[model samples]
Target: MAFNSAPKQFGTILLGVAGLGAFVLNLPAAAGRVTLFIGQILQALAPPWYGRNFARQLVEIGFYSLPVVGMTAIFTGMVLALQSYTGFARFSAESAIPNVVVVSITRELGPVLAGLIVAGRVGSAMAAEIGTMRVTEQIDALWALSTNPFRYLVLPRVLAAILVLPLLVLVADIIGVTGGYFIATARLGFHPGTYIQNTWSFLEAQDVISGLVKAAVFGFIIALMGCYHGYKSRGGAAGVGTAATYAVVSASILILISNYLVTELFFAQ
Candidate 1:
């Protein structure tokens, strides 16, 4: 019995590793699928079947996530202001605090942090839910009923995430900047008008737009990973757990890597 169980356990581990490796190897294919799916969504004049599902996903992934993102942004902004002030004060450059906060939040921190948070919350949830459905053969049932799973299930989520994340990031940017403003004026002894003026003066249209673009891409990645992993889930309850974990981990890493690439593209001139 012990010998038989040992082989089974080893096989399981081997299979798990192989699955992970396959996931990594298939990144290009996943990217291709994403592009194709996006094209399908964009070309449809009015995909009535997708509308309700998309709205539901928008609420789930975006509206419900605002408080956490808002709190994260505010604290991040405040901490950034304090740290920037401390660093700049050593060089008598304290007046740069507002500008630093604005740039930091809009250019990097706001979208990345928001993406990470949503990955933990929304990504995991999506994976678990879809994984459970897959394991239960619901996805197969949808196919049997002549419904395209990609059209009905995956497209709505991908579209909703792509559309909603930018709005969330925009709100987060405003809240973060306000938090920095409050800290700069109230705790750091900077004049309120000076802080606001400096923040606004230093902020360009590109900084804001670039961050929103990153947010949209991050959202797409999060949803794609979740849907892909979950849709491919096998086994039973354990597989759902694994899918959720993989979704979060993969989405987070992808978001960070994509963020760096986008930053380089936008700022490397």
Candidate 2:
């Protein structure tokens, strides 16, 4: 037993060292991926713009995404109102519900929720579509035809996400605030006029703008993660499925991380 314990301990130490080496090896690969993604964005801005593809992506990512975004926003706002009232009651600050709802929605919840929703829906769709093309050799076909896949496929989706997400966030802000107003007036016995006044007075242009900015960044992250995973996919159908899952998960994590960074940039004292 004593002799076996020493061997087992050495094996465990070797495994831990190997794991650390693997992590260190991955760092440069991750940097390469980020570099490639940036290059693609730059290429997207150059000539040979595909208006038709861009329009289609715009409709798909923005218009089709509205219903889900709206539902999430409205429900979030309503819940915030209820919770805010419940919490503030202890301090006799129930009158602050409208201010809290509007501020919270416009400043934080609206963009974050919308980004997460779109990332799950649109990011997965992008990954699936691109991964299918990769596994089917359609991407190679484009290269054979002297067409750049980055410009033709990646640009449209990325640009559409960056442009349309801000608009979606704007709509989310309005719907979320309105939902709070309704909850306040109809159920919470808040004076409609006073609630509106308080919301308007408390919310600044900075809050709305910061959230929209976050939305645009989140959109970029979503599209980038989706396209990157899908474009790099291998192993056929299973790889395609994995790409879709990675797109959603990576986009979501990036959204949360970027939300905090952007907030710090915009509001840090």
Candidate 3:
């Protein structure tokens, strides 16, 4: 019995290994397909640019998303300030908290949190809506009517995300730093004027620019994953659900990866 069980376990392990190898092999192809998809969308970028769809996408991804992003940023800033104070107080570096909070919020946390929030919220919605349309034959109907799905369906979403996310991140940076200021001054007994002065003085244009740039990249990734997965969804209802999940997960992972790369590009010595 043990021998038989051992063989079964080994077979299972071997199957898992094969699956992993297959994913590794297909990664390049998957990447190529995404590139091709973006290229086709660009090629389809002609007049009639679907102005209404772009407007709707802008409101959907940006306006509806603000409250959640704002809340998350404020709370994260509070936590970061409190946590930093713990370490900083020990080193007699409590005065640096304002500079640290401002820099960290504008340069890293603001863009990253905003991206993740949008990915989870707007990205999933795009995937599910498009996936449902795909399953319900709406996309086919559009194609039959001589409409290019990339232009009609995808282009607006991508463009709106690119335009709106930077704005969201900018708002988040301001709110996050404000939250930290409130915490440091009220809870930690910091001088309010000095804190504000340090925060304003220490923050640079490069830091804010880098974060906004990251937000744009993250927005593109989120929209791309959502639309791509939704477009490829085939198995009806269950496939739509899978596509939504894939959109959120992939957007989030790509956001983090791109965040690091952009940070390196901007700040690496």
Candidate 4:
């Protein structure tokens, strides 16, 4: 009996190995699909666009998202100020708190945190909504009506996210600085005027611009991942949930990766 079963076990092992190889090979095809999808989105950028949809998307992505972003910024700044005080105090460099706060906020924390928050919030929403539309055949209905789904659905959200994220990052930068200032003056007994002066002096335009650039790239990645996953989703409600998860996870990972690349490009030694 054992000798007879040997062949069957070997066949099963071979089948498993083949399946794993197929899965590994499919990664390149999946990447190609994503690249093509991105190309289509960019192609839709030109020509007469849906102004109303774009406006709505802008408000949805930016204005509605402001409160959460602001709250996050303020708290982060406050905490950073306190933390900087602890470290700087050890070296008798407490006077550098304002400089540290401003540079850190404008250069890294503000954009990175805002991108992550939006990825979790807005990116997931985009995936869920689009996936639902896809599963329900709403996208097909649009195609039947001679309407371009990419133009009507994807473009507006993508453009809105790309445009507004920079603005959001800028606001986060301001709010973060303000929060740091408040914490320093009210809790740390810092002189407000001196703190403000130090922040102003140390902050360079390049730092702020770099953060905004990072925001734009992050926005593109977020929207693209969400739309790509949603548009390609199958199955049913389970697919929608999967798409949302993929969107958020992919967007966040890409954001961090892009952040480092952009930082290197901007400030490489």
Candidate 5:
């Protein structure tokens, strides 16, 4: 009997390990599926289904997100300027402050940081709201009514996120530069005219464009993760909570990872 039980336990452990490995392996495939879903939705572009919802989502995801993004940009810019000035001062290159601030904000910090903030704020909210709907059978009811959930629900938020994030990042880039300008000119005693000149002189069209592109991608990731996790939510309240947590965490991680990849692609010679 003992020997028989030992074999059973060993089999159980082996099965568990295999399951874990399969889950790990399938993560990339799951991500690809989600991407494909998004692509299909984008390609379809059915105006009657996704348009009105998209406008509502724009107000929810974009208009409501401004204050947090603005505040974050301002403080980030101020701190970055201070830190950069200190570092550059050691090398007698403090005059590079404006250029560094502009390049850093436009090329990387503005979009990446803004996306992270939205992931935490908007991503979790979306997941929670949609997950609750799923748990309460509202999503099923919609399906019963012959409404395509993806067309009515997911596509709108996704489109809104993609459209709004670029605008938010643009505002962030400008505000961040202005914050850095204030610190550099006021606290550091740099000339305002020269700082402005240095900022514009070093920043190119590509830098701004690249950051906007990244913002759009990050926005899609944020909304996609939220909708995917939320729509597939199971169990009950606990499951809804878990989905929301995973949505935010996964979106944030993907944003950071993708940011590096995009930077490499854009800046690599």
Candidate 6:
């Protein structure tokens, strides 16, 4: 029995070794893909820019995403105010509600939530559009016509996202703070003037700037993941659908991870 078990144990060990080897090999492959994707972006920045396409994408990503971002921000701010009051009232610190709402929105929630909403809305759309082009051999047709697909399709969207997301986040910050203000004054029986003063006095320029910076970085990550997955898509329709899902998931995860890193950079003690 011991001799027979020895062969089975050796087989399991061999399988584990092979799995580890494959995992190690995938690291470099992923790195190379990232390198190539970035290279394409850099090259797209050269002459023969697609101004019209860039404008279109800007409207699509920034303007079109506003309603969703706005609603999310408004409700988030309201809830924050209500919750802050509930917790602070226990300690007789209800006066801190305004400060908490403004600081929280500007420092963290505004940019993060806006990025997530856009990642879900625009990122998936980008992946589906480009992946479909890839699957249908339209990308190959562009190559045949001497038109670089990255320059035509990828650059506009990426640049638009990088440029527009900060503005979106700024708007979200304002709307969120306003929502908090309304809920505090109207629903929670707080004095409007005092709440506004507390929020204004407690808020700093650094908070807003940090959030905008985070928005820009998040935007870049969102577009990068979408384009990278879509550009490399294979199989067929099923593959395009999978690429869309991957784009949203990857962008959302990167947004959260990078959010912590950026916060540490700005606020770490």
Q: Rate the local accuracy (lDDT) of all candidates.
A: 0.90, 0.94, 0.94, 0.95, 0.92, 0.94
Candidate 2 runs further than 4 Å off? 1-17
**lDDT, model 6, position 241:** 94
* Model 5 per-residue lDDT tens digits across residues 1-269: 99879989999999999999999999999878887877766764665575778899999888899999999999889998999999999999999989889999998999999999999999999999999999999999988998878888898998899999999999999999999999998899999999999899999999999999999999999999999889878999999999999999999999999999999889999
What TM-score, over all chains together, does every model reach?
0.85, 0.94, 0.97, 0.91, 0.89, 0.92
**Displacement of the residue 100 alpha carbon in candidate 1, Å:** 0.1
Q: Candidate 1 residues 127-156, lDDT tens each?
A: 899899899999999889987777788778
Residue pairs in candidate 1 whose N, alpha carbon or C atoms collide under 3 angstroms? none
Error of 4 at 81 (Å): 0.2
| Best-fitting candidate, scored by TM-score | 3
Report model 4's TM-score to 2 decimal places.
Answer: 0.91
lDDT by residue for model 2 over 176-230, one digit each (tens)?
A: 9999898989999999889999999998999999999999999999999999999
Better of 2 and 6 by TM-score: 2
lDDT of 1 at 167: 94
Q: After superposition, how far is residue 109 of candidate 2 from its true place, in Å?
A: 0.6
| Candidate 1 deviant stretches above 4 angstroms | 1-48
lDDT of 3 by residue, 140-243 (tens): 99999988889998999999999999999999999999899999999999999999999989989999999999999999999999999999888999999999
Which pairs clash in model 2?
Answer: none
Residue 110: error of model 4 in Å?
0.5
Candidates 1 and 3: which is better by lDDT? 3
Lowest lDDT block of 10, candidate 6:
40-49
